[model samples]
Target: MTGRRRWTTDEILGTAAELLRTSDAESFSVRKLAAALGTDSSSLYRHFRNKTELLRAVADRTLEAAMDGYRPPDGWKERLTATALRLREAFGQHPQVAAIWGRYGSGGPGSRLVMEEVLQALRASGLPDEEIPARYHRVVILVTALIASEAGVGALLPEEYEQGMEQFRVAVLGADPDRFPALSHFAREIRPLGVDRRAAFDEIIAAHLAQIEIAIP
Candidate 1:
């Protein structure tokens, strides 16, 4: 009699990742995964010791997907921006992955390798060897913070959120025009700046590069 083929760890992980992307992570359980895979829940434990380990593996796989096909450009600034955008796109597509990314130490192989490349690029851009690590940490922290914020808050906002802010600013300035002369004079400009996040990201990257250049000499 022919033996039944078994599912490999990669298949299991890949399937789980797909589920995560398509559904909420909280909704994914071993039973559901097994049902999706046409197997028993117990089979997954053979590959992953527990649910947490499986989740971690899923997160690693997600990071790998994010970093896939990322090649650095000639200029360090360009490379940094590209890497950040790649990560952003990856997390934006699979926001569930971002929830756990910050929970783990910044030592996952994929994340570490990306950081190492960034450090190398910073060094090439005239940053001192001793300072590269710190600067790299800063870059990672800043980019990840942005991603985490998006994941946690999501894109949804009440229709009144912005309008409410604007109303409050105008009301406060109108109530005490002399008390808040600057705010009253620049009420429109003072209302949150309405900066496009992509533009802000580019500006932050440019500022970092400028700092690196200044520190080089």
Candidate 2:
């Protein structure tokens, strides 16, 4: 008979993420993960203190994936934009991990690595050293909040999810033209302006960049 297989942390996290993708988040358990890995919960516990830690680690792993192959651009604005866009894509690609990150709002080594890269870009933006900490917080909040707002739908049932989006469309696009002139204007122009998420993401990033640009020395 074959002996038991030993799993590396990467292998474990990868399988954990896959299980998160397929299973209900609330009901997902270590036993299920162990079963998927052909091992016991004890083995997983050795690597992670508990389920929450494991989930956080998985969240970091997701961030690691987002940073993979990303090269910081020459200009600070370009670097920030590219990083934000990469993160948005990663959230879309790994909705489960994104949901966990949104809830936890913290990270491990993987998150630290991404933070370091972002800080480097922020420093390159020529902001005062005294302001870097606050600005760094702002960048992290803006990027993650936007991505999480869209990623929250990942856990929803298909029908319910569509209903929520439909509600947004009806509420915004169907608002009174007189009362909400700006929204009405946007609604009218939205079609040619590209109403897809990429458009919204670009606008938000642009606004963020503009704010940073104004603050630069």
Candidate 3:
């Protein structure tokens, strides 16, 4: 008879992530994951203490996946931008992971790597020693807030989102030129780009970098 198959920690986390992609977090459980793996919950408990631990590991694994091919760039700005953009892409790719990650700020190795890189880049910015902490956190908050906004919209149903966008486009396009000169003037352009999270991310990051550039001197 064949012996029971053994599973590695990485394999378990990978499977969990795959399951989460299609399943809602509210319904995910160790039993479900075990069932998916064709094993039992007892087998999974050997690797993780509990369901929460397993989810945290899965979230951390997602972070590592985001920085899989990352290499520090030459300049501080470049390094920071690269790391931040990778995170944005990862969050977009794995919205479920992003949800869990936002819940548990569990400082795993992947989280450490991101924080360390950001701190290092901030150090290279020549900000005052005491101000670095505030700035570092500000950067984190800005990215998290903007990405979360995008993710929230993504969680809405397709028809619901399209309907909302249609309402917004109508409101913008129908505005009077005299009362709302700027909105009327840019209404056509805004209709296409108004709900564009990717463009918003790029623009916000560019503005933040510009602020950093100004403070560098």
Candidate 4:
């Protein structure tokens, strides 16, 4: 963390990412990140003009790691699903890193590469030149929305939810059965929103793929 170590741009960004995650991105600042790095704000400012630029760098790093060694599945449906799952796996680690979305200005090389893969997959699936753009938009929205929402939630949630779920169910069950019959009946089912996330992801990906099927015929 000492400047005597001569921090590299990548090293600074990686540290900044950890700091952002630790603070939940709500109150992150360059000064805070510099403190975490054991350096002064001016040093960080030299590499990144401001927090926004630094965050963009962190987001790009996450994006790059996610897609670096990825190999798409054989089928278009599988390839798209694989990509989404892979992205979620990486993005989930630095959940707060998502603060850079859209406001970060069209993303860096890593995001562009990810988008290219999606476009190529759609085209390879025999989607018409005209339909490819629309499909790309839909697919990107689906993937980004899923990852961003889940990662944001995961960042705020505690490591354990079992006890929380039980508490929630108990509270719901306290309601009068007759007046709140439906709520009482489904209390156990709605215990916790958490479940097999991979299955949930697959189901969402499948639904999107089904819609894209129309483009094939």
Q: Which candidate is the best by TM-score?
A: 4
lDDT of each: 0.72, 0.82, 0.81, 0.77
Candidate scoring better on TM-score of 2 and 3: 2
lDDT of 3 at 70: 88
| lDDT digits (tens) for residues 1-217 of candidate 2 | 9988889999999998888776655777899999999899998898999888888888888888888887888998888889888888887877777877878855677798779988998889899989888988888888887787767665566887678768778888899989998988888455422137677888898898789889988
Task: Quote the lDDT for 97 in model 1.
Answer: 66
Q: Give the runs in model 3 whose Cα sits over 4 Å from its true position.
A: 155-160, 163-194
Candidate 3 overall lDDT versus native: 0.81
* TM-score, one value per model: 0.73, 0.84, 0.81, 0.86
Which 10 consecutive positions of candidate 1 have the poorest summed lDDT?
152-161
lDDT tens digits by residue: candidate 3, 177-206: 999999999988874433666877888988
Evaluate residue 206 in candidate 2 and report its C-alpha lDDT on the 0 to 100 scale. 85
Model 2 ranges with Cα > 4 A deviation: 165-195
Q: Residue 28 in model 2: shift from native, Å?
A: 1.9
Answer with 2 or 4, whichever has the higher lDDT: 2
Q: lDDT per residue, candidate 1, 1-217, as tens digits?
A: 9665599988998888777765655776888888889888888888987777777777777677778877788887788878888877777766666766655533456766677778878888877788888888898888887776665534324564577656776675565667878767776555343336667767776787787778885
lDDT of 3 at 198: 80
